[model samples]
Target: MNEQEKVKFFEEFNNGLHRLGRITLIAASLLLIAVPFMIGILNDVSPSGTGFLSGFAKVGIIYIPVAIVEFLVYAPMLGVGGSYLSFLTGNVTNMKIPCAMNARDIAETEVGTPENEIISTISVATSAIVTTLVIVVGVILLVPLQPVLQNEALLPAFNNVVPALFGALGLKYFAKSPKIACIPLLLMALLCIFVPAAINQTSLLLLPSGGLALAIGYVLFTKDKL
Candidate 1:
């Protein structure tokens, strides 16, 4: 189809997808809440109202900010359909983000385009399915794999999975735009070195790190330095 027709079609498609995503998310939320309530009702171990509220507040207060930040940081990169599917499936950073990025790169689609959105959606969906299958297989193999996995020689490798993944991904992006990436990379490294506690609260650190990068980019843009 022509550009106008294509854009119109994508808009309609995205609208429908958003409606379905919102409804399904609401249903999923209710079901999640209902399961605990139902079990408590059936088992006669219901938490006191005060205790429940207090506990919910404790966890919610910690996670709510992180969730909001994650959405703000990731949504632009993920786009409409990809965000819907990735958020629904979980594993946004470790699995879905990388999968979508790789798909867009391989397909040579610029971010925010319909083609990129479609590729990201498919990539995230496939990643989720593959992740689920891998989990299932891992569970099935746990008994056989236990000794191997628990080996002391491999322990360090297991512990550094996130760091290793990010290091590789970061290097690739750094190569792409070293000027933009260098600020955050150095800031994060210094934070990790001096503060140390920042490593444990990486999610919270996203705000400052991202803000710094954006501010630097803005300065560069205005000064014609980029």
Candidate 2:
């Protein structure tokens, strides 16, 4: 196919994928919300609607901002197909995103390109399948593995998994674009050092840190200093 034909084909395929993804997500969300209510009704002990709403609001208030920030920050890197699968599968930060990044690195495709989209989708799909299998296996083995998992010595290692994963990923990108990385790195370091409490709300902090990096990069490019 020629360039225009190829572009049209990709657009049509992406739109179809999006339609299916949206319908699946809607159905899944409805079932998740309905099942609990259905059980409560069957048990003849329906929860107070007000109480349920209040509880949902409390949790949603905390996470809504984080979810929005993550979407904006990750969508470009993930593209349409990968974003749909990754969001559906969960574990975006620690698993799917890392898997997609490694795939992109291996494929040598820039983010937002068609090649990157394909690589990201394949990477995230593989990660999601593996993650699901691991979860199923873990659940099946839970009783047998409880003691080992609950071991005091292993607790520390478990807690550091996220930090270690991000540290290694961040180092690679930092080396590639140290100038662009510098401001955000320093900002995050200062936030961690002075307002250690902010660590818990890392998603909220991503806006300013990422924005600074983007703004600096733009300015440097305009000034021919990059």
**Local distance difference test, each candidate:** 0.86, 0.86
* Candidate 1, residue 45: how far the Cα is off, in Å: 2.1
TM-scores across all candidates? 0.61, 0.61
Please give the lDDT score at residue 127 for candidate 2.
91
| lDDT tens digits, residue span 1-226, model 1 | 9999999999999999899889988998899889988998999888699977866766676678789999999988888878887888898998889889999999999866899888988898888889899999989988888899899999899999998998899889788767788889888989899998888877667667767877888888899988
- How do the residues 96-127 of candidate 2 rate in per-residue lDDT, one tens digit apiece? 88889998999999766677788998999899
Off by over 4 Å in 1: 140-226
* Residue 49 displacement (Å), model 2: 2.0
Task: Candidate 1: count the clashes.
Answer: 0
lDDT of 2 at 72: 97
Residue pairs in clash, model 1:
none
The superposed Cα distance between candidate 1 and the true structure at residue 34, in angstroms, equals: 1.9
